[model samples]
Target chain A: MHTTDTETFEEQFAIEQRLVDSVVASFDSTTDPRLKELMQSLTRHLHAFIREVRLSEDEWSNAIAFLTAVGNITDDRRQEFILLSDVLGVSMQTIAVSNPAYEDATESTVFGPFFVEDAPEVTLGGDIAGGATGQPCWIEGTVTDTAGNPVPEARIEVWQNDEDGFYDVQYSDGRVSGRAHLFSDAHGRYRFWGMTPVPYPIPSDGPVGKMLAATNRSPMRVAHLHFMVTADGLRTLVTHIFVAGDPQLERGDSVFGVKDSLIKDFVEQPPGTPTPDGRHIGDRNWARCEFDIVLAPEQI
Target chain B: MHTTDTETFEEQFAIEQRLVDSVVASFDSTTDPRLKELMQSLTRHLHAFIREVRLSEDEWSNAIAFLTAVGNITDDRRQEFILLSDVLGVSMQTIAVSNPAYEDATESTVFGPFFVEDAPEVTLGGDIAGGATGQPCWIEGTVTDTAGNPVPEARIEVWQNDEDGFYDVQYSDGRVSGRAHLFSDAHGRYRFWGMTPVPYPIPSDGPVGKMLAATNRSPMRVAHLHFMVTADGLRTLVTHIFVAGDPQLERGDSVFGVKDSLIKDFVEQPPGTPTPDGRHIGDRNWARCEFDIVLAPEQI
Candidate 1:
């Protein structure tokens, strides 16, 4: 056969095709259907992205640089990249899609980006609110089965914003002092006092903040309290119980953490009621609330 | 409500949730959906991968350093990262799934790691044989439209390795010598003289080679000639014309460059027969082969 003078553009596209072959060949064989599908889909999308964009020399370099920056920003206490994910709605989507909590358990929200293990422990009915936010308010809750039967000695941990809407961990140390951990009593009852809820803006100095500013968005979060409940043979629950009347409750609660079932109204009460801890308040205006959580079966 | 007096693991998870909320609240509405998806997926996968693999601090650091090295090795003339794609099969898979050749053009192959611009102009029938690899051979081909009409004055740029499997470009002037651009005559005929085809190993000294080695793979490629053809009324075509029976064809070209249609046999001719340029072969056997190229319509 005589050699042809010209080859078609299909011949040229072969270069790209060969690259794809090599890429798929590199993945490990997996039996997990989801993983397999995800890997294949990711490869397909990534390849298409490169081609659709006709990614060029300098553009490819810029992408590499961007990834490097993401890695550089991650640290022990700060995972800017993870924070970046949470803000992008990916974290919520992934968790929601993968593990739908609508089957009786409380809807799990995104695990926020800040946490310091080993918060100081306190007993039931102990005060956790350090003098930062405002006048004290009493919060009480019960840990029970779905039938309302108290689960004796169930562990109930709680933390909330100080009067100024900041947690103790946000500051270096001793400057904010608002974090507290508590466990339920023998009757599955728990109570504590702290400043009233207040709205506060999220940190705007990080790259996440910069991303928000670039698109003309705000970073405020509605007032809420953090809770973790667990007991023998029961599934652990991670949730945020929001204050119903806080101004930011409806529109400002970041990460879509609001659930009608989790919202509680704070009622003003006469300062002095027969207190379980024996401290009498002189009939002054005070905040009071009561709620109970039902435990789910443990998947483990 | 009063601050909580007790703390539990559930409470800690709640705090984590709040932090997540605060962080996610920071994203603005203008972020790219793809980027958002990518970041979120990355976070979930990375977080899961870490947990699944039980990645230690040392392992994580080493992975980071490896990425840093990949970045460090990238520069203007070479991209080790792309080579990473080649070995990982990402490059080949991407090219394959997004093949632009199915619209009635030649089968495509990978754009090997090395290709250069600036080929010197040579007239039709010019010889590109310079490096000392295989026996001498004459290559001729035609460029035509789908209807078999000749396309006059199409530019055909040719390149290939000497018998020893080293490209002329890899040798002198830090640039090769045999690579040249030739304009087809009115007959759409283009011809060049070069060494007979022989298999050559891709560069194994680079990171790609290292990866291949780690995976117990070889890097030999079948003998072939590279070309980039273009004309005023057609889309540009960049491809390779492979020599049949060079070995390593069916088992797959190590660089994944083989296409069934692109391969051709080099028929042996008596030493004394007149060659395409009317030059007699001197004392040694010579070979000849012919092929044609069909180009796509011009891209607007």
Candidate 2:
């Protein structure tokens, strides 16, 4: 479309649309069909968004600068882009789209940036609160197939922040805490000792925090424990269990990760209750929760 | 909207929609209403795009990496983000949206990154080809208001790359060439001697270039001269005059800066025609072009 010296608004809009089409068509020679399709859709949607909002040059420049800052602050320990996606709910949306609902299977959530490979493994009923400070809590869960049959020897990786809301990586001293891997017993039952989960704010000292502040939004995730459960013939599940009564849950998770099934009651046990391993009861208070995970069949 | 253990596709979609709504609502407390509105619209559109495309985790990671590379390559001397926007047609779209159609006024284009402030000032008919090697060309233009009345004493800033297709900033020797500022004569006419405009590829040693190559798109912008004309009571015009009949014009410009009205014929004159100032027309051939710029009245 050729724009003349005197163009009506409609004509100019059409010219812009044609330009979008031209950009989309430029991807015709892309060798990867998926990339071609993605690029075309992205161009169309991005242009439409710009036109819809009448985005100004100053706003565009601001966005570029904001994105650049996000990239600049990124490093081995921090994934600001992923955090941006999480706060925007795009990560959860992608998870929902990629992992469709299966009958009685575990719902997946975002695999946050803190997962570490080769977490120290523990036996069933072992404590994973190494060098961590918090109220002791017993986490017992079962791993089973959709048919309710036991899936023995499944690997369960659990990670969370300490009571002070600091992850192991966040510590300047390079201390490891509040994260470990364990295998389910022959009865498909796994239990470990951990800290009582607490609501915590995501890192907010960077550009993303500035964005959240500008938008009057909080950068807090609900109290929760992250879990990645993997079995021999089932789909791997990365999910989280939220503390049922955490105020942040009602306020809505910043990452959009709170699902109804994933919320569990962290029952406070009185000091007189007997321990699961026949240990003597102590005056210290503790919490207990039981979560049963169901895995979907792996595609052939 | 909470998701249960059993969710139909529609139910899951509703959940995702609710997540989007929550995010949008989170911006309700934004102090700046315009920013709040923009954030809401942007969040909705961006979430919708992700849902429509069903973007996968791997694809999302790829996008993050690509944007990081683009940001990493950007610096004072180079702006890869702007290049990315230009290639995607966003910069042009923003210009079109920002500058609406004005009656008989010069249409604006992108102010490319090569523009340097405080360029050497020259007389109405001075040569701006400083320490540059190229076939000589004469550019003459008149500045007029919308009613076709000449506006005298207008400031005109002209800049372009040398015949080698490299802007002054792109050189390593720290030499300045092919750019200058001049004022129009009493008759609102201005003329200058410089290299013949030639099509040139944008810097392709960055991530934006990789994107272009991957998408099978060219990095060549159409041959053109950059101009910024400003007068006392008239709106400033940032635009380009494309050399007509250039092959790249038909192929589409990399920056989407070309417009039908901005195209002008650069007529070739074999070594015989007298120069504009009656300078000796030696054995060297030259070209000539006339561009008339019209400025709009500045709004109060």
Candidate 3:
């Protein structure tokens, strides 16, 4: 007794197309144009991805479960979704798009999860490796404008993992080390003493780690130091300088933070070498690196 | 002392492209070809989407938070992610892709979150509106092959919300109503006395509902009855029959489950009219609908 009419494939596709239109139209009343645009673009790309993959019911369910796991494993100390994005190269791509191309400016990478606000300020050539176990290293850098003019009194924030490949916060001993804030002097020069960088595996105990394992990808990042530089009339610069000869650089950093221009040689020095401040270095051998930063002029 | 080299936009894009390639290549060792393909395609599309959107850090954080909220709100009684997919048209697209068009076959839609296992069975011409309140109605259907041959004794599972827009499970009163199982008779015929379907809002109290509100979209679905038909030699069919001329049909369903061919007239019958099974006329008027299902041949 029911009607015998059936839809052809073309008709079904039309129905789906209409659905997409309806979803896109639903956002027309959004108060914020940017949010509307984002929602519309997200809907289109999500639908297209599903269709392109011919996603099956089981596959969809698996995706849902995987995402749920990713959410569940995320917490104060870990950001599995960001890790997922990083592994997919989305984080780096976003940085590239957001920063665009600025001549002579330090290239930005992912502002990783370990930055601590208001790290203790250090004086020129001061040691920031308080109670941290690592090879002693001296870091000096100069701040300059895109036009090669020295930018005096620019604030430089630096943080990095110790030789053991762990940030100061990662330790449970309630100690602060391996990170500090400093300012460029009148000559646009700044220096600090810290630990030699060591390549480290990203936290690999969460859903993101499981995904990496399943996909046969390593979770190692090239040894590096994070820097954030700011001056009154210059655009802020957030970046990392990778050790020039680190093996992980050639192998591809897990977070895709390595840039050829940002790599620097961490020169080795024997014990008892004269320090930059006219003091004799300790008996322990040390390494040194100089990274000069150039900032783009801020748009009015 | 640091190198003054800077990468151009083209070079940065090339680095990202290589990173994407590396991520895709990581899947080559996957034992399952389908999973490998899915992961690779997912990586490529995800990277493309990020680049196209030029997603900002704040936007990325918002996305992560939104997904986490969706997962946190999902449980045994609700599936927020599926609702997210439904609202975005991904669910309908997936259904369309999964179920290809077949001659004379019923069109499929999404299998929503309310399906329960082992619903009570009803015999031919049996009443399935057990101890529930709604306008009386009769539903009759036939199961046949694409060639119009009757497929005797096919199983048809039915479920729907009551006039109050609540499924039996949605009620805390432990009442059983609005859903049941029925089998076709020898001639591939089945009939059940039920209740009139009514438009209802999808559970809008969670993250999905918030998303809809944020996007200015309604969460209403047109009046419809869900059906799942299965026979020995035919592919199983899961779909819904919407009430013809339901206002929501043209307005667009919240879940995008509506199809032109699946909409049918629920003809109203006045009191004192003889029933199809020769039953006595009742004082209260009732509605009647016939939905015949034609299933495609199952692949071996």
Candidate 4:
């Protein structure tokens, strides 16, 4: 390559690439190896992306402004960054990479930022809806090891949105509903009364929504219920059972979280139909779903 | 490759990789070709980074919180995201990729977020340090095309921190100094009185500062004077003339904006030395520097 320092754009670009090296090397002093690796890899990949696109200065300015808007709109009531991550498929990708599929363990999904540690404890087969407004639904499942052995007394925490597509936590009224924890029985069986999962947009009134609109992508997510299950000697599982036959599945879930294995039939019952435990109900429709969870042995 | 679904972590990992493909394909409906390219490339690069790092869930949460904090502290007066980009070297890299070095045209560096429009215009050899406190200095520069012809009347805009290391826009005190625009004379030469450059730490007290402290990096920027020059039928220049012997150059600049070609000597002068334009000064030292700018022909 015959060239002066910047005789051609390629030569000049080479100088630019070397700066990435300098940046990656800057992380050498990081005491933690993982942090160092993360920073360096991030530098490499980010630079590669910029180099690939020859990202215009205007584009870069727009990105910075976009992120600033995202941060400005975020507060205790709303986490726009999470919503941003979800829309970008970063949240789901992170979920995918972190939770390696182990022997028949229920495949994990986004542990959405809505999980509350102090959810009221409910007994098996009891109502977990706690007055959140939605169609009455019956849910039952078995918690078992990969070997099909019953895992008794397994802690199962479930949370979901109401028919209005808002989590109970989203309310400012200090109300808690549609969320609770219970333990599986000796036969590894558990049942609960909760509202049916409803398809909802993931907090789209923020910058992420603007991005989706700009890219011509839908902000809708298919209906699904969140579950976090833990038992002794088994890896904890965070997953969801999405409603089958939801039309959004064919299009795309905003978070890219829907998987074929996670989809289950949400059987709908006509108004005045008999409840599982014979609970009385006026004329109103309901749904029922079963999700059998398989847990992998704890690695440690 | 013989395997059942989720049989092994690797096999399952393959499924995770497929999600990246889907995310990229989702951009197929994007009507704008450039927007589609940027989004798809972004998705691929982002997913590649996540997979490469196998970033933990906790780390992901921390990152979201970090960005959120960064955004929260930003106001019209402060741009934490720009500082974040500076520390991460993204700003300089963008400058590199966008402004392909051409001819002897002053190599453009970071177009720092400090430039303001409607800067008061001044005549040649006039004082630009209006109401700003700093050691006096004289700056003279020639504007010429790459072909060595004078670019007479080229518009020269300059801005820099005062001795207190703050830009006029950074204060709500209703003051402006150390920044003004002037035009080159018929001889393509310009001169003005201003302050000597001073090194300063970027705004801290926020998440970007926390990140730098955690990684053992300094937030200090080397002393420099920012310059932006433009002329008709020529590419505009945004650059800085760094103090040649500033110690921070050996350590590191937070923004990685320094280039060897951009450094110039700010020679000190005795108080009573003959002023360049026959101006009177009390017992105070001054510094002087010369910059001859070369502009490339405007591409359009």
Candidate 5:
């Protein structure tokens, strides 16, 4: 006759706590209470998530494979895994959860996968289109405090896709780059000529793509422009302003970037005299869009 | 004046869903139901976990660092990351949550990190323990059916630490290099001479070690014998039997391998007649323990 003892799921979870306690007892000199709390909380949640899922061998192996692929696809230029997070809404969710805005402050959105340092500084009213192929538009925007006073000299880092649906940094020619760092003028007003953004597809050639493919999904993003607005005594706001009438607007993006308050209509403007680009603007259909941003109280 | 739109968390979650939907909808051929389900569920849980944590920039960076360290420590002979999982209970939990045992079956335990594939096979009654460093004992056990009939020719892989707490596989030449593979005799009895296991410390020179140190935990494991038991018409069982009175028993192991049913007492055995190892009389202090295994039925 065989004798046996059965251990229940609760017993197993309790066993986990004991083991964790033992492990935690070994720390030497980490006086950071916040770090300790973070580690403990992370361990608890990670353990609980494992128990709740009842994860299996094949499943664990596949997760390892997915992570391996995420690393493999990451390089200097692109971060496919971060893009994965963005598309999955983790990035935006994190932004929202950590940076809740004060009433009347500009809301934050995803800092998409393409922001870079060293974008060439451009003067006020300098066109950012860089001869890129896209719909010609005059974009004017203001930065203001919650009290409606103009906050002059606010920095705006503007970027968007070209008519061909690609960033200048994504190409070899280094021309037609869509990024311009400009300061708000004395009246908190800024205007620059640019080509209207076209809908673009997030890169789909990695494990994130395989994951999306396995789920029967698309990779298209809606028309939008990324903005980073910063000023003294206020927290920086990372956000995107999307075009109003893009088909993908109602459909939304694969990256959770659309906000009703951030969308603006683009109205056609009568043509004017051509600038120095040797192209006469009066003959072409021109468009105009205006948006104003309000800053939030700084956290630190 | 700023225009405002009130957005609910549900609305945010819906927008997140639409984003993932767009990304997933472009897939051409995803016929595997399991893969399809896994992809979507992984995305959903991952999204939820991020929101639940409200992960911040530094936190995210640290997470990346932790995973990178995990990958860096992984190698062919030593999978530190797998050891990390074993310590964290993920490995055992993965197996256990999926493999519920029926009545009369032996329980499973963590497959510790020290398994080596090149064990030398020996016949029944062989001196698997090649040295006198450990307390000499003959391990005699039977493999039997749930009805108590002997299971002939069953394969058993036995490995343990010497009295000084070191495995043969762990050192190039340690006395009582406790490792042996033996088969059951015609009557289903198997015997091997080996020393009594002593408590041993797990390696503490990696990220897992760092984590343990930070948590204020010990690195010692309870005395135990590892076994891989198998027979025809029965599913394979990988398990360990722990020494009953080891000090590490009270606090449990950092790896959480102590199961009540798998704990056994190691009693002092009386000497027998002259054995093959050249001892004239049976006057030496020896240890004795026994373990009988029951296996799950095969599918066909």
Candidate 6:
């Protein structure tokens, strides 16, 4: 080494690299294999990101403060962390990695942070919108395997925000509406009465919303109904059927949950049309969308 | 694009990568260039890490929950997020990146979460260990520039955990001790009475503790005293001097803060040994350490 007072960027970078190596080596004592791999890789990638940006101390502190705010506002009803991941495309990416494209199986998307473990159950073709305010819509679909065989008894979970862009849980009052779980009938057909999903902003009174505003991005997601269908011996499908031609879809869903195949036409019908299941709807306009679900075999 | 139902890993990877690209491009409309760059780099690196590991949905949710806990517990007193960053070597790495190596000047370290602004001012050689229980120790240090010129009137801020391993702030009672600010004298020499720094553990009753336990890493930091020195036209030094031969140093500091050069001999004195300032001591043992700090120019 020449005796030069100047430390080149390469030399300076080498010092930082050694610190990274030490951190990586420190994790060598980790006993669990997966934990070891994860910690090591995470350290490496995280350091690489910092080094790439040469992140300033202020920036780092700001990030810590932002994340802390996100956590502080998060409770049983609000999860700003998941909202953060969704906007960054991480949630969708995880779904893509876990559920491979198999034989035209229904695409999977993020199971947003709002799902309650125990949703009210509804009978076949019964109204599932308990007390939410919205235009009553009919959602009909059949659960079937990739081979076109009926997946009888497949459990279907559906939830959507009301017309006011608020979930039932978002209200302070204890209310359980606009969410229900039902099992497929013997014919693999399922139907329910729910509100027509309208484009709505994700929780915007939190840090994620601040981030979006800072970046000049919108917080609204495309109109869509969330679905999670599970059957024995089949890969559970977590996806959404986007309302066709929604303006938000043209602008792109904030959560990146939209796939062209998942977009379906919600045909509007005049008032007093004959009900599919003889349920009366006097003088009220309704909408209908058919979303057929196909399950892939277990172990993608 | 070819007709291949096999869906090779390469193809799947490409699909995932496209999502990364979309997320990156989404920030194209960001008004601020720095924000744009930071957001895009973060997105790319984060997605790459996830794709590299094929991070499972469960793992993602777990990470979200862990971060939520970190945020929930972080208040004015405790900062779990910074602790998480410190243990992962991110804080130290950021310090290294921001402060480059200069002409044999004092090294810098993390400005740990415990520092309080406007610590009680102490006169030269005055005791700073007010209301804190510990063996009285004398700390003397000279401040100078790299050219060996004395830097008088330099502000030196110092703080450390008590012998009980808790900062004054950690106590429920409103008390300040073991911390003070003083200016170097005309000769650049300064001394203060404080507790002999001892080893301690970071707050570990939260998710970060569980993570350390799962990874088999000890949570104890080496014995050290924190110092921050600032003067006109000199870079502020946020650093620590380790008590030489501390066992935790051998085991490695939990925050990866121990540097060989920063370890100084904290000489123990038997009872009746006169302090540097000739303060009367009954029968209690004491320790002393000299830490002369050389500052780099402010522009570095």
lDDT of 5 by residue, A59-124 (tens): 865765566566555665666657877766767666766666466778788887787777778887
lDDT of 5 at A255: 78
**On TM-score, who's better, 3 or 6?**
6
Expressed as tens digits, the lDDT of each residue in B1-300 for candidate 4 is: 245654676675778779988898877889899999999999999989999998878889999999999989888767889888877778888888878776576788887767778788989998888988898889998999887899898999988899998899888886777899999999899999988899988876789888777777787889999989999999888899998888888988878899998999999999898889988878889989998888878882
- Superior candidate under TM-score, 1 versus 6: 6
Flag clash pairs in model 6: none
Better of 4 and 6 by DockQ: 6
TM-score of each model's chain B: 0.76, 0.93, 0.93, 0.94, 0.83, 0.96
- The C-alpha lDDT values of all candidates are 0.62, 0.85, 0.81, 0.86, 0.70, 0.89
lDDT of 6 by residue, B14-115 (tens): 779889988998899999999999999999999988888888888998899889888888888888888999989999999989887787789999888788
Measured with C-alpha atoms, the lDDT of residue A64 in candidate 1 is 45
Write model 2 residue lDDT over B36-125, tens digit each, in one string.
Answer: 888888888788878888888778878877877876777766778778888888888887776776777889988777888889998877
State the RMSD for candidate 6: 2.0
Q: Given the true complex, what DockQ would model 2 score?
A: 0.42
TM-score of 2: 0.88
- Give the per-residue lDDT of model 5 (tens digit) for B212-299: 6766667788888888888998767788888888888986676777778889887775676455445443467777788877766654
> Which candidate achieves the best DockQ against the true structure?
6
lDDT string for model 6 (A59-87, tens) is 99899889889988998888889899999
Interface quality of candidate 1 as DockQ: 0.09
Candidate 4: which pairs clash?
Answer: none
What DockQ results for candidate 3?
0.37
Q: Per-candidate DockQ versus the true complex?
A: 0.09, 0.42, 0.37, 0.57, 0.25, 0.64
- Off-target runs (Cα >4 Å) in candidate 1 are A1-28, A31-38, A41-64, A98-104, A130-135, A163-165, A173-176, A250-252, A268-286, B1-300
Error of 3 at A81 (Å): 1.3
For model 1, residues B261-282, the per-residue Cα lDDT tens digits are 8888888888787787887668
Better of 1 and 6 by lDDT: 6
**How high a TM-score does candidate 5 get?**
0.73
